[model samples]
Target: MQPSIMLLLLLPLLLFSAPSISTAQDFDFFYFVLQWPGSYCDTKQSCCYPTAGKPAADFGIHGLWPNYADGSYPSNCDSGNAYDASQIGDLMGSMRSKWPSLACPSGDGSTFWRHEWEKHGTCSESVLDQHAYFQAALRLRSQVNLLQILQNAGIRPDGGFYSVRGISSAIRSGIGFEPGVECNVDDAGNRQLYQVYVCVDATGKRLIECPVLPTSKCSSRVEFPPF
Candidate 1:
């Protein structure tokens, strides 16, 4: 056999056997983020309800993102494993309700989910495979009633502005840990309650106090926009 032919034939085998590149898998905690649907839709870019129809009038799962204690995070840790919705087929009903996508162009929530899994979920694959990751987030979402928590604290999302600290206190009262409240400006430039970041153990179970939080751009009061 010619040397070139031998090299060409052996190339496929070498490529197939190449070592998988290592990614930063170790992480300190998770930001089990829940987003307000109304705030999400009221932004300048706007949003589209899922093809599964409108989600419930409540906070929904944004992601279960892995992060370092220093506030740094990991992402795209598994290029080899893309999000296969079939892996989480059984969780669709819950996902459609608890994690609906409101981004354009319109979608059934898969694109949003795929972006989350690939960017955030993949970093935690060492602990939870795709199915477990999605399931665990749903479980966490079920455990906390964010809307009820705020309402109980007299912070209704009736397009009324409320103290940011008070909102955090309400969540801590309900869930036993203070949460990080993030806000965004609406189309009319009103700062609205956007996402609530709660920390979780590395295993994606049980909420914990956040080690670091997204810089809160909220004022003394932020609008809890109506859905």
Candidate 2:
């Protein structure tokens, strides 16, 4: 075979074998964080419901954060790619249901959603656009069913304190992977359950082992305050 022909034949193999390169903003996984409304309200003194009114007795979506395998993450990746509430029209209903803002002076959840989108969603642009990013979080929330899992484990949010082991076990049993549990101290100095963060693959489609286990100040027993 001619040298030139040999080189041409090997070109495709060389290209295929080369390692894929990614930019700094690229991420490897997602942290789907769900916050407990009761805990948030208890800590914040007051809570504001969306214009649609108070959310149901369920964990609200804090954000779907993009994380790297190295335990680092990117934020505000694209300053130009600002959040636009109008783009997420169809998702508004679900967002209100599963991801309502419990911050003060709510009514419009857009501000909170915008912050999440701009800060975290932009970092995931390589895999998900604005709409898909929000939708993925909603879908993950529905799929995880954290409330149902805890309830089935006799861990209702009735202002009862639950063992961190029990809480983690319930989630692991329900979702097939251990999740990170976080807590906060209310005004009364009670250690209350705050958030549950489950790691998802970069595609935001499937759960994966967390690259770095989440650390929490939550003790062996954490309160599951009622909303």
Candidate 3:
């Protein structure tokens, strides 16, 4: 065949064979992780309140990470899909309130959010856009009153300790699924409640049974420190 004919035959294949950003959909589920601010601040490393002021003494969102069923996960799936604050302008208030960052030298939660978006959120772009990604998390956060759930079950955060089984059981009873409880040490090196990981479906909505739970370093009885 002539060079021109050969080029024409390969043009369609070349265009279609390009890698796509939507392969991010292949992940099995999302780990909707929420961290307790009191436990976070109680650590020796400490934490700083956001510039806007302190967040509520409740569970703050960590990230809605995509993960495989076999304990593997994907991240930074699409460099092209950069984090843009403007895209989620309408949901700014919800984001700041529910997903506040407790990290030191905190300006606003934007830096934390951008990092989450770039690292984890980008992996879920197949099912959610930039706006939907944040909105889904905010909505999910509202649905689960974690502190209320634990308190209602007599698991108050008054520097008291409770069995890890008890904590997970109460949350599971309230939400109808098992929860992954992670603990961190306080200034004095006592293990305290830190983060709670709940599984959400791939759609980023609806609570589901965790295909696999995150490894929690909690002692048999972990402290739930007050803020």
Candidate 4:
């Protein structure tokens, strides 16, 4: 065989034998979502108490969302690892106290939690199982006391609009890293403080800086609606 022809044949074999690139879903960090009660339940049409009852005036947990460094996130990555409420029996009390669902016609908060676990928790199985995932979120919420920190900084939730810089600064000072602040406009066309998201390491242990901070739609002045 000619040397050039032999080389061409070998090239095809080599190319076909190379390992295929994987499309398996993986995550880098977590977004611990905290929802402001006032913002969540502002409109009569939007508010609904859970079977467990209404959440306190404090911020209620939204979810511990798994996210990529490129600002994308994964959801329902593994349906086989479906959420099991029985598995989280021990965490019920803490979840009720800290992570209650404020959606309408709430049914013991199971639906909300199930949705979160299935969507976000399934993506974190390698780092934390079902129990650990919920527990980590609860612990993070307890550690990052948003209300108290803002209170100390004189930023009360008294239906008053505050500067975006001031709100972000208070959270950054409290948690050692700047967070992604979200806001929504109320019936009065006023931008109300909504959800606050903080990035957490994959192990669900440490709070880390977000590779790509979430955009805040809030204007220069946002109202911290009263609970």
Per-candidate clashes come to: 0, 0, 0, 0
Each prediction's TM-score versus the true structure: 0.88, 0.90, 0.89, 0.87
Report residue 20 deviation for candidate 2 (angstroms): 10
Regions of candidate 1 where Cα sits further than 4 Å from its true position: 1-25
lDDT of each: 0.91, 0.89, 0.92, 0.89
Clashing pairs in 3: none
What does the lDDT read for residue 149 in candidate 3? 96
Ranking by TM-score: 2, 3, 1, 4
Residue 215, candidate 3: C-alpha displacement in angstroms: 0.6
Kindly list the per-residue Cα lDDT of model 3 for residues 1-227, writing each as its tens digit. 99999999999888887675335458999999999999999977899999989998889999999999999999899999999999999998888889999898977899999999999999898899989999999988998889999999999989998999999999999999999999999999899999999999999998999999989998999999998
Over 4 Å off, model 3: 1-24
What tens digits encode model 2's per-residue C-alpha lDDT throughout 58-157? Answer: 9989999998887888998999999988889999888888899987786678889989999999999988999999989989987989999999999999
How many clashing pairs does model 4 include?
0
Alpha-carbon lDDT of model 2: 0.89
Instruction: Estimate candidate 4's alpha-carbon lDDT, on a 0 to 1 scale.
Output: 0.89
Q: List, residue by residue over 76-142, the lDDT tens digit for candidate 4.
A: 9888988798999999999898988887777788889999999999989887899999999999998
lDDT of 3 at 84: 99
